[model samples]
Target chain A: MAVRDWEAVIGLEVHAHLKTRTKMFCRCELEYGAPENTRTCPVCLAHPGALPVPNERAIEQTIKLGLALDCGIAARAIFARKNYFYPDLPKGYQISQYEAPLAGRGRFRLPRPDGDREIGIVRAHLEEDAAKTVHAGGATGRSVGADYSLVDFNRGGTPLVEIVTEPDLRSAEEAVWFLRLLRQTIVELGISDAEMEKGTLRADVNVSVRRRGEEGYRPRWEIKNMNSFTFVGRAIEAAIRQQVAAHEAGEPVEQSTYDYDADTDRLTVHRSKEEADDYRYFPEPDLVPVEPPAELVERLRAELPERPADRIRRIEPAVGFDAAVELVTTGRDRLYDRLVAAGAEARVAANAVMNEVAAAGIDPEAVDAGELAKVLGARERLPRDVYLEAVARSADPGFAAAPFLEQEAVSDASALEPVVEAVLAANPEQVQTYLGGKEGVLGYLVGQVMRETRGKADPRVVNRLLREKLRA
Target chain B: MAIDREQLLHVAHLARLELRDEEVERLGAQLNDILAAVSKVSELDLSEVPPTSHPLDVVNVFGADVPHESLPLEEALANAPEREGSAFRVPPAGS
Candidate 1:
């Protein structure tokens, strides 16, 4: 069958690690790259008779995210034990939400190439992370050819929120856009860093292809533990091709879980449906149901920062599309808004931030917005080099651009004439060229005059003075 | 509800236990008996009552999100069956 004859149905399950100070069930420090097993406790290690105390901030952060995503907060959500055995899981089961989750039935609108399309979020539930496992004596460091493996409980019990989306995405591109917006929302709420490289935000993709206009979905194949957005897109594409080929060849596509090898760019089937684990889910008796106070939820909802889409819409007209998108997507629109509130011209501040600050690799928050506004306010008078320098220096504490602001463009004819005369005398060849109908030489002369005046002479003044001199 | 030998084996596999045939048969009967006793509660017709997952009267049981000193490296790895550096060593994992 032709590729266009089929439609791909895709859903994503994203796990975002919470940025709490401690583990979900214990006081162990929640950190990255700490000494192996150094953060473990009896509770996280699943020592006999040890009890778990849930982390309050994790719940608060989860609620904040749910409200940001417009999800309905459950009055009572139970934690259940997803029974499984893996070397990485010390408890032999993971504490997760199954029958009832913390929040459910939300919609996330992804800004698609066509338009805004809403993806239904089935649920966003809280869970604890498994430990890190390192495979030794393998070129890929995976279990396929490894001689042995080691487990580190340092990451165990880290609070995580798993968001499951409905099969609304039609292509790999849409899935990526949804993930990008979801990451932005999570980061904007200060819940998680959502860094793909750190494994803090990862996704499992479910993909299947059905004949166009078909009513029901076919059995889907799951691609597991994709760390990067690019990989997720590639895996989905590969899975779709595999499914289409199977259908075209008159073979049934097996429902299975596959691993995407980044180096080889291939999908290796890990387990089929029959081999899938039976995670006999039961309520975790150690912990009680989480019922966030109604007052707290209301407060979080009222204080929710304007979402990226709405903020971009509001600022697009003033800042233009590209700058507005950069500001919102990078979580720096707050700085832009503060600059505008501090009396900076909206368009000028937006351009200065997107062009100067962002280009210099400086965090928008590190730079003083008011000082940046002052620098941008003088954009017309200051040369591009001076403007960028001032922007970079503005990140220093107690920095003011008063001395640099003193240098204004020389627009008056009287002030610019002598500088233009000096430039003309230094380049008589350019004068002769301009007299011989090489009008472009006038630009070269004007550039010399501006350079002599240290970029303080207005180009218009220099151009007019040079033309009059050359004409004579 | 009936608990057969296959169901018992499946539960044992999920728990990562190896059960002999005779053990599976014995556990199946024992589990069926326990389920028969618990099945009486399912017959109650209290439609308005909410299902309770915990026996406690509390709703939210949480601690402040603050970090305390974690277990020392030695103590953290002390109970591991096999240790490599500071980590616990396990058999090579299979796909």
Candidate 2:
């Protein structure tokens, strides 16, 4: 059976840690590289007789993200206890939303090769992160071989918003594109850093493959704790191939959890279906149900920033599709917009930003929009090399392009005549070829003139002058 | 709606409790009685009444996002059953 004969259905659950001053329930400061257990508190450590109080700022941030995603915010949402036993979870049960999530039924659009496609978002709910468990004396430093483990409670109570998507994705490329847009949105809203390397943003992907016209979904296998987007794409492709092979061999694809080994490009079963724990969920008795006020919701909605898709649509006409995508995906569209507002030509500004600023490794925020506009506005007068050089130097503070601006290329026919005459005399063979109906050799004479003047002579004027001189 | 001995043992296992045969049989009956008592509320036709997860009528009870002083190292590790250098030592963790 060929690969295209089967359809792969993929869904993702992205967990982004909220950027707040303190932990979700406790007042312990949220520090990334702090010493182990330095941020622990009685509530976060799950000491007996300690109760949790909700953090208002975390709730507001979650609602802000939900609004940005166009999700329906739940007026009355309650946290439930997800019961399990793990060394990382000091409390036997984690406070999460099982039935009443904070937001639901949203749709996010991804720019696909075949236009844009909307991916359904099942829910985006708030939950507390678990502690970090470090296993030592193992080959992989994981819990596979001999050694005890140490627990770090500092990261235990950090606030996280888990965004779960419906099984609307069809290919691995689409999944990665959706994640990129989602990360951009989260970072734009100042919710989370969404840096996968720092462990703030992570995902667990569920994949299943069936025939093209299949109705319902088959039992899906979940790949857990994928930290990098590149690894996520590889894992999805590997899982689909594995499932398709199983179907071809008359073997069943069991519903289970698997861990993807990036080094080996293999999926190893972590836990079977029978071993899956029944997270006996119940409402958390300590925290009260969250009912956001109507006025608060409305205020947040009104203050929401423009969505990325809408920003792309507004700029796509001025800039081409590739430049528009580059601007929006890199989170530099705001800078581009500012340059446009400052009287810079949209198409020129887009090219300068995507080519010059990006290539110089200069931070977009560090570059002044007004200075960039001045440099790009003079693009027509300056040669391409000089224009690019000005764009690169615009990152320096208090630097103006006008001070170092070059004169316009020599376009006047009378001024360019001598240079054309010299080039026609030097490249006599090329001029002869041109007179013999080899019209392409005119470009060679034009290049020789521009090279003689150090790229200061306009090629268009040189072409006309050289044509008349050589014909004579 | 009857609680069997197998179900009782499963719940005990989930809660990390050991039970004998007689204890399982005895607890099964008690659980059944408690379920029966709670089942009476299900019989009421309170269709319009929204299910309440909390007894309080309040909502949005939260603290400000301000950092406060955490407990000292000694105090933070005071309640741990075992401890290592600046961390709590637990048994071998399963993946």
Using Cα atoms with residue i matched to residue i, what is each candidate's TM-score against the true structure? 0.87, 0.89
Question: What lDDT score is found at residue A176 in candidate 1?
Answer: 86
lDDT of 1 by residue, B1-95 (tens): 98777778777876778988788877888899999999999899969998889999888889998888887889878888898988899887764
Model 2 lDDT per residue over A1-472, tens place: 5779999999999999999999998999999899878898889989889999888988988899888877999989999999988888988989998799888789887765347788999999999999998887668787866277888899998999999999999988888878888998898888899999999999999999989999999989999879998999999999998899899898988988999988888888984424347889999999899988989999988888888876777788899677888899988888799899989989878877787888887778878788779877777767777777777777788768775455557787888887778777777788778889999987777788888887878788788777677667
| Cα TM-score of candidate 2 | 0.89
Q: What CAPRI class is candidate 1?
A: medium
Over 4 Å off, model 2? A138-140, A271-274, A342-345, A366-371, A398-401, A404-406, A416-472
In model 1, pairs of residues that clash are: none
For residue A259, what is the lDDT in candidate 1? 86
Residue A106 displacement in candidate 2 (angstroms): 0.8
DockQ of each: 0.72, 0.67
